[model samples]
Target: MPVWTLYGIRRGIATTSWPEKEGPTQPGVLGLPHYHADRCQDNCRACADVCLPGALSFESCEAEERLALDYGKCIGCQLCTEACPNDALTKSNDWAFGVRNRDDLIWTEALQSPPAEEVTRKIQKYFGRSLHVRHVDAGSCNGCESELQALNNPYYNLHRLGIFFTPSPRFADLLLVTGPVTYAMQGPLRETYNAMPEPRWVMAMGACAVSGGASGGGYSCGHGVEEFLPVDIYVPGCPPNPAAMIHALLLLLNRASQHVQGGQVAH
Candidate 1:
């Protein structure tokens, strides 16, 4: 037998059984920020004032005052946590942040008064067993791309779940996209999406792809992937960890349910 083959047999399978089993956990992984409107100061705008990406905003309503949080625009800097004088905002440990609709990422105290509705997705009917993804870098800083590469490592072995990274969009069932959509790359990104077959899906993999991350509308970059394509899944992070990415993919296929809703743990 070859030496490499013998070594491989000795090492055994290194793949993780996450989403299916209680697998490896990242240390101190911080996810979506939780908001406590009741704790918000009467007339304070501390969080909004220090928000670098303008994700936090104040609105004056006829009967009540409200604070709105667009999670897509947040880069998870946690600056808002420190900025809030009333401790209204705090760090979240929940990281499985894939959602079926984009609207789920936006939250307001006024609107959250009503109970959240259950969401249904038809992706599993078409892509339950396996999925092929075609990735495109619209205009990334490479932070998102680096985390994506880790998905294939021994620790995460994304292929174990029947998910693969395909080179050709013609054979792809999903478009895994990263970065803020740049004006120059918009045409190419659309072309890739158009090349895919029917029953296709698109995933906005990072804060940049979700809502332009720290780089909002600039001279060269557009706001986010949704501005150019219909994104079916939104995974928010400066660059989401490998586990979070896996959760998003499984959620896209309907193999798993959303755990984070309106900045609170759902499941």
Candidate 2:
């Protein structure tokens, strides 16, 4: 037998059984910063100041400045954790932040789920176990693309889950969008969405796709695809890892349960 073949044999199956079981891909990598609003000090905007994407912001209330943390705009840069002198914003491993609703990504917000049976029936009827995705680059920095490419690798092997990425939108059940929708790509993005059949879903695949990331509200960048397209899923990261993406996609198909609500991860 060839040496590589022998090595493979010794390794057994290289693919991990994740989403189905406890197959962790990235071990200790930091995810979005976890915010403890009660721990936050008065007049402290340190975390907000260091935030590049404005994930951490101040909301003025009745003679009070409440720190608002929006996971949709978080890029997982860890700068806020570093800048926080009050330990209000801290690093965490809570990367699997896929949600069915957009408001669930906001801090201190409440989230409610639809009837599971209704959702399950609808998903099983259209997608079942097999999901065909079409990725559209409105205007990405390609960080998300790099992580997305890892899905088909030997470790992750997204195909085993019956999820696939199709080049043509006509055959896709989900339109996975990345980046802040640029002015030039807006027309093409709309055209692609129009091609997909009814009952189609859209997944905001990154911080840019969810809420425009670092470049949002800036020159040459729109807020996100959600401004125009109806997003069914929101996966926020500078570039969500393959594991996180897998969770989000499955969450969309109702094959998995959403863990994050009101910007808090369920244990």
Best by lDDT: 2
**Every model: Cα RMSD to truth:** 2.6, 2.5
lDDT of each: 0.82, 0.85
Which 10 residues in a row give candidate 2 its minimum summed lDDT?
111-120
lDDT of 2 at 140: 93
For residues 1-267, what per-residue lDDT tens digits would candidate 2 score against the true structure? Answer: 569978878988888877667745688988988887778898778888888888888888888878888899998999888888888788888888888878788888444533223244677877877999999988999888888888988888999989999999999988999999998889999999999997788999899999998977676789998997998889998888778899998888777888887778877
TM-score of each: 0.90, 0.92
Candidate of highest TM-score:
2
| lDDT of model number 1 | 0.82
